[model samples]
Target: MARFELKLPKMGESVAEATITNWLKQVGDKIEMDEAVLEIATDKVDSEVPSEVSGILIEQLFNKDDLVQVGQTIAIIETEGGDVVVAKQEATPIAVADVAKTVETAKESVSAPANFSDSDKFFSPLVKNIAKEEGVSVAELESISGSGKDGRITKEDLLNYIKNRGNQPAVAPIAIGTAPVVATQNVAPVAQKAAPVSVNGGDEIVEMDRMRKLISGYMVASVQTSAHVQSFIEVDVTNIVKWRNKVKDAFEKREGEKLTFTPIMMEAVAKALKDFPGMNISVDGDYIIKKKNINLGMAAALPNGNLIVPVIKNADQLNLVGMAKAVNDLGNRAKAGKLKPDDTQGGTYTVTNVGTFGSVFGTPIINQPQVGILALGAIRKVPAVIETPEGDFIGIRQKMFLSHSYDHRVVDGALGGSFVKRVADYLEAFDVNRDF
Candidate 1:
């Protein structure tokens, strides 16, 4: 038999690692080529890892909830054919009836909590490194409170423990491959569980899903990172609406796609970014990096009710037709959970359609690394004064509010206000007779 190592393949340009969410196969299970063996989840996407060759699964290197780096061996498969016989070892320590009790203690040190090699509890490599640096015993690690998903100890949890390590009572260090951690009456409790709340029987509690948790952290981080300030302006988009209504049918018939007002607004936003390139910039520490490319991030809601931003690169380069295509493709893929990692990266600015959910206007939080995000409000037909060559009269017109949120540290009121104003200007100045 020949042995093959199944490694986690590279998922995307920016993704370096993924967390093992589940295992579909156990040891000694028959596997087929290209069949999924495990499911892995990155920050923004979930995907299955498939077997590269037909084999019998022999071992699993990592358990569920463990973070695995790209190209790392996750499992072993034994294929039929070759004369090569690979050594297989059980994850647990084997007992030798002839060995002394001291030898058993050594095996315990090599496998369990004392030496920190407990496979039952998942500790990331980063956390293990930090533990090694701080001289924390496996017993101590078992005690540290984990705030991460599934009670997994995170790097932040380890760092916080280090910061407060002085308050911890001094204990004898348990050396790896040496011996077990001696139990004491003064020992601090590890694996602190949250106090369970008593349900009234009718009360149903729903914990946030993985994506929602990630989104929650991101939203909080963005709020803390940027000095957010918003500017709101109302614009009359009667001409743009009229133009879209006039051309939508013909455009759909000709281009084989429905032409929506989103692309039209996105086109105007892109042009306005070119007009005021300062808005097309990102904030670094004490530095403002002005972006040359006008990549627009469109926030789309997924079927699971999670929000994702799939970007359209070179928004300034694409015409109305191309913008529609890009918007449709990205929007469709995002909703279908088919967007690649690169499709969500390199966004210099973001636009969200709050109108889709019936919100009149919203002060949206900024997408990190980028300075600004624009929220488009619901369009409504309201009475307005129409100034003509003859006289001024009250007439009905379609209008929507533009809510622009920017980093106050880098963008002043004038620039933020003017950039959004330029978008309004483009929308108001749209050609009624222009061809798609």
Candidate 2:
């Protein structure tokens, strides 16, 4: 058998090391080529590593929860030409002559049965302590199951069983001789009272994961470094909505994907970015970096209670169909927890949709060095005035709130407001046939 060493492969451009969260195979276990062998979690993401070749796991060099560097050897596998086989040691049976002696010795070591009493029953230390505190007999616990590891009795199990039994009627008291005396009842039923519900619910304190903690730190740093400003504008999306409905069926059939409002919004944003390039800029220590490329970042919510803003490269060059496919692919991958660090890096600007949750408006935070972030709110029907050549008419129109948060250090309020207005104008004048 030839021995092969398996090392951790590089995960992403910025990722250097990862922690071994779990091992799917143990030593002496047979594994196939390309089979997942271990799971690794980095600060940015988590991924599973597959085996390079079919082999028997001869030895594991690292333990679970161990931090392993990239390209480090984690295990050694033994391959048998093409089919690997794990070596197992044979066990010898015990002689029959020694069984009787062993049983006799065990019987002598075990204590004789005591008088029928509550203390004579077998109870774990924790259960015994709880029983003593509650004045409950061990006989009362015979009907309850032990929920602890290895069928051991736990305090919770006993307490819950007692609580359940307390709801039922009490058993009849045993009578003693001539005097008609009652049997000794040590345990008393606890009062059945419901827990008081608070008017305001308590907040849950959950520890932040590595990525969330990093993001929080970066947010605080950005606020400290830049002068943040926010501006809001309401846009009439009646034309855009009508145009989308007219072309949505054909677009989906042609691209084999459903067209979302995001791609349409992205097209308008790209045009706006081209007209007002200052909003597509990033701030350095002292210099402003105006990017020629309009790489738009879509903030995707992850399943792990974190957010990753993956950038679509050169979003300005892509058509509506292309943008839709790209957004669909990225959002699907992000939701599937498959995004790498590089996928989220090098963003020029970000767009967040609070409309998915039916939000009307929200002042979004500027994503770090980037000058601005656009927040899209839900569309709603509202009364609007329409002016004709002959007369003016009151009509219902679809309206949406567009809030833009920008860095005042890099982009002034006038420029930011004008950029948002330009986007709104483009959206309001959307055409199904016109290429943005």
Candidate 3:
């Protein structure tokens, strides 16, 4: 038998590393081909890593909660029928001068934190690197309270600590992989403390899950980063409603997908984006990034009550049938927790259907970098005055409120208001007799 290497597969272009959440197979366990061996979670999604060849799991290179780079060997599997393994010659030991020079270079640049491999607490690569750069000892790290979930230290927390740690001496670098940190310093906590909550004796205290924690951070960051402003408009969608009611059955039968209002709304949003290209842009510091492709982000609600936005690439090019298929596919996958990491990337604009939960209207926070997000309110039948050449009469009409939340910094009132108005106009003008 020969050994085969199991490596972490590339999840997406932007994704470089993932944290191992669980190990499904242990050492000496017999594994089948294409069976999942471990589960990994990136910043975007959680997924399983399957084995390449059927064999006994001989070794695991990383443990749970360890950050592993892509294309790195994660495990070793013994497989049948391969070339005989050959051992390499032993290498020479490092010279003393070379060792000193290496240490000097590390001191000048970035270095790995001492005893990080032996620490029980997980420090992300970023945090560990920052600690090394700032000469923060492991004991010092333990003393500083973390603001992240489960008391885990985040980059922001560490940076805040460093900034507030005025005129402190940089600790001497400890030998790598040698002694555990023995020095403890009295460092003032820099994170702003949350107001204490009063708990009743019968109240249940539940910690936020990993995804919820991440979402909470993102929402707070977006709010702090962008100047949020909203524009509201009531749309007469009686024609689009009648059109969908008429063709949904035929559309679903022919297309093998249910025709929903989401696709219809997405189509209109895509068109409005094309018409007013300024709204499809994202901000980068002092620069504006005008996206060439119209990728629409559909905000989907998960079964766990959390949210995920899976993107539809080049949405403007798809027809109504194609849009419906894409919408149904992404929505189903999102609910099933089967969406890949790339499906959540590259979004130029976003649309959320508050109508799903009977919300009449909502002021949604801007999905950051992207300047705008449109919230579709619930459609209701309301009485309105109808005017023709003959006379005016009272009529019942189906209408919904379009709430557009934009970054007031980049998108002025005119651009933000007109963009949503264009979307409403497209939906209001939808042809009742249009083909599927």
Candidate 4:
């Protein structure tokens, strides 16, 4: 028999830790390879951690509500087989500290073990690099407290430490990048704390769930950061509606996915973004990052009443059939609580179908860093004027309103309004006779 450590798998590039919600198997519980043994929840999604090898659960290192770091051992299993290690990809960001050193300490950091925790706490690679550059010894690094998830050291924590480090005295100065240390310093004391909430009869006070809290913070931050403005346009999707109705059954039979207005709209949005590359950009402080790829974020609702946006990478490259598959696959996974973290990242622009909830149109909050988000409204039959060389007459048409919300800080009125107008133009000119 051999013992195998079941580590918390890396979730995503930006994600580092997750809260263990439930453990399906306790010690001595029988387990099979690839079977789910525990469940975890990150800020993004809830997921199951499966057993890597067929074994009996021997121990669980973490408990419910305990935050576990990626690559940390959460459980150990006893298997009746030779060692078959599960391969894992670890994030290793490399950087050089701008420190003129005796060269010994800096060189030592190069051979430093990947697990460069100053204490029992784990530190990310970026934090370690900063420490090495700042000539922060292991003792000094541990003395500074952590402010990240599960009390892990974050980049901000290190930077603040460097700023106030003169107050603390520690090991002999390397003289390379060491700060002037003071032996004596006065420390501030906490006098009082906020009162806890009191519940009274007929009072219903529910704490915001983790996901809700994250979403709330995100929306508030976006509104606070961007100069928000909106542009509205009414689109004649009469041809689109007619085209889908005529070919949806055949399209589904051929493509094995439902034909929704989303993909059709996405196709139009992608083409518009291609024409107006300025809208396919992200804001970085005072600079604008114009993206070469047109990745579209399709907003979907979760079962728990929260919202998640799963991106369709390189959306402009996909054909109508490809778009339908991507939309349906993401929508189904999102509704089923099965979306991966990567699915929610790297979105250059976003589109939300407020129409799904009978909304005429809405000005959605811009997803952060990204400059804009477009809202699709409910399609309704309305009477319209038809013009031709022969004559002009009143006709019934399917129409929907579009509300484009943009960051006025970078996007001007003409550009923002014109970009959405192009989307409407594509929908209005959809090929009713085109093949699926």
Candidate 5:
């Protein structure tokens, strides 16, 4: 039988390694070519790797919840079925006492793996709890490196260890009775009563995800790296709204795409960036790097409670319709958990829409290294006077406020304000036929 080694596939430019989150097939299981073999999690995104050839799963090189480097052999399959040969490697001795001593000595210097533990513990809370529950000694747990929180044990680690125990078969109990009388036993209460109030409010502890921790670090770094300043402008988008409604149907029909306000805003933002190149720039350690192309990053909110900014590369080159289509596709993909790492990189500027959540105005933080971020607020109908050559007339018009948060290190208050005003002007004087 021909045996083939399956190596980890390249996920992205910045991604060098991934944690094996799941294995769909076990050793000796038959698999088909193009069948999903495993799921891997990188820092940027999670993805599934498919089998390249149909064969019996002879052996697995890495267990689930193991950190594997890119291009490493993950599995071996025998195409021409025969006896499976599993590669046996010597196990590392676990020095539990030494590890515990190290943890105590380097508590401040040590950081737990991102997934499993806090900075303090050698084992993450999940791993420690699992070991405690499973009655697995610390020495045994120490032998297994964590897939989360700096090689700290995760729940998956415990599960995989349980799976690898060939001596026992893991199974759920089957209920059998004359009439299958299922007891609705309240082993645990569904809800708990509140504790008695104290002078000081009771404190609650919450865990932070990797993304949140990264965001927090970036925010602090941004504040330290650049001097930030914000500028605001109110614009009457009545003309643009009217124009959009008039031509949206025909435009969609012709382009086979629904027009979104983001594309319209992107077009204006692109033009403003072109006019004022300072905004389309990144701050280096001691110098400013002027980006020749405008790669706009649209901040999209994921369905499962996380924020991702997917960049539309070379946005300046795309027309309004193209911009609209790109935004729609990226936003939808992001919500569907299909964004790749490349979609999140190389952004010169970012635009965040808090208006969708009924936010009238907000001062958005600058996405680090990038000079500026624009916050678009909800549109509301407000009374205003329109000055005409013939006369002045007062009428109710739809208006919106646009706020720009810029790095004062690169762009001055005047420049930032002017850029925002230019975008406002473009939105105010938008012509559906001409702009689109």
Candidate 6:
């Protein structure tokens, strides 16, 4: 029997590490090749890691909630083979210094007040450490709702609780102790508590799901981080609309994919990015990193009412047919919750189709680190002036609005406005006679 190292596969170009959220297989469990062994979550997405070779799960090198770097062996699997494969060095658990750093970073205005072991509730090691340093007792931790899987208290949930904990009255009276005194001194100044909502007898209160909580945090953080600004442009897409109508049936028959307006819009967006490369960039603390490739992030809404952005790498290189395939594949996978973590990584720009919900136009928040996001409004037939060499006449045309939201910190009005305009220009100039 030979031991095979089950390492964390490389997720994406920008992803270096992930947090192990759960272990599906324990030690001595019979494992099959390509069977999922564990689930991990990166900042962008969560995915399961599958075993490479069929074997017995001999050892687990990392615990749930621990950060694991890429290419590190997470577990050891024993398989029938000629010779025993020498195992690499054991996985290093998070060091004391790392834990201290994590606590210190999350520690803003409060110190630990209560003992954690007093309660039977399960808390992740990282969340417990943060709770310890931030004065969250077992009772208080329990009172705060969790948005993690199986209602587990995640670090974000704990931190958000701590942020709002000071506004409420103390859970219990402080006894005569120096620890309480220090904790009080370190606590944030008490702010006005939010007004309570008056619920009717028939009203129902529902806790947000894990993904919705995550989305809430991201939306709030984005508004705080970037100086958001929006630019809107109305374009007549009669040509593109007619063109898609003319070829969608044939295109789907030939390519085995439904031709949607998303890919066409994405194709134009890609061309616009190539025309204005400055818009295809990310901000890194007083520095600007211009992207070499046009990776468009397609923001798709899931069936669970959550949002996800799956990227099309090198979108500028794909033809219209390729773009449609890429868009359809990623979109289908996203809806099915089968997208890998890497599918959501390294997006230099994002596009959201608000039109799907019948919105005429919307000022979308910028997906951060990246400077810009585009929102496609719904197409509507409207009266328009038709100019020709022979005469000018009123005609019905399909029109839609393009809303561009960009970080005003790095992107000026001219660049942001011009980028969306270029996208509109491309869409308006779409070839009606082009082949699929």
**Per-residue lDDT of candidate 3, residues 1-436 (tens digit):** 8888888887775565688989999999999999999989877777888887888989999999887866778898887977533222122221234333433544355334465655656566556655765666676566566765345687767767666665544444447787544333654445787999999999999999778987897798788878999999999999988988988898878888999899999999999999999999998666889999999999997768889999999999999989999999999988887788789989999999999899999999988779999999999999998899999999999999999999998999999999999999999889888897
Candidate 4: misplaced stretches above 4 Å? Answer: 82-200
Whole-model Cα lDDT per candidate? 0.80, 0.74, 0.82, 0.82, 0.74, 0.82
Each candidate: RMSD to true structure?
A: 10.1, 20.8, 7.7, 7.0, 14.6, 8.9
Candidate 2 lDDT for residue 168: 43
Q: What TM-score would you give candidate 1 relative to the actual structure?
A: 0.71
User: Clash totals for all models, in order?
Assistant: 1, 0, 0, 0, 9, 3
Candidate 6 lDDT score relative to the true structure: 0.82
Q: Tell me the tens digit of each residue's lDDT in model 5 across 1-436.
A: 8786777776555455677888988999999998888888765566677788888888899988787766778999888655544333233222244333433433243223333321233453334434443445443454454554223466666657644644433222224553322122312222477897555457765689656765676677577666878889999998788888888998898999888788988889988899999789987655779998899999998766778889999998998888989999999999887787678878999999989999998888888769999999998999999899999999999999998999887799889999999999888878756746
Alpha-carbon deviation at 64 in model 1, angstroms: 1.7
> Residue 364's C-alpha lDDT in candidate 6?
94
Give the per-residue Cα lDDT of candidate 1 at 281: 95
lDDT computed for candidate 3:
0.82
- Which lDDT value does model 3 have at 231? 97
lDDT of 6 by residue, 86-173 (tens): 4444433322564456556665666545554455555664676567666677756766666553345776677676767768555553
Worst 10 residues of 3 by lDDT: 86-95
- Model 4 TM: 0.78
TM-score for each of the candidates: 0.71, 0.67, 0.78, 0.78, 0.68, 0.70
What is candidate 1's local distance difference test score?
0.80
TM-score of 3: 0.78
**Candidate 2, residue 109: lDDT:** 39
lDDT of 1 by residue, 267-314 (tens): 999999999999999876557788989999999988788999989999
427: Cα error in model 1, Å: 0.9
Off by over 4 Å in 5: 1-4, 22-35, 54-58, 63-65, 77-206
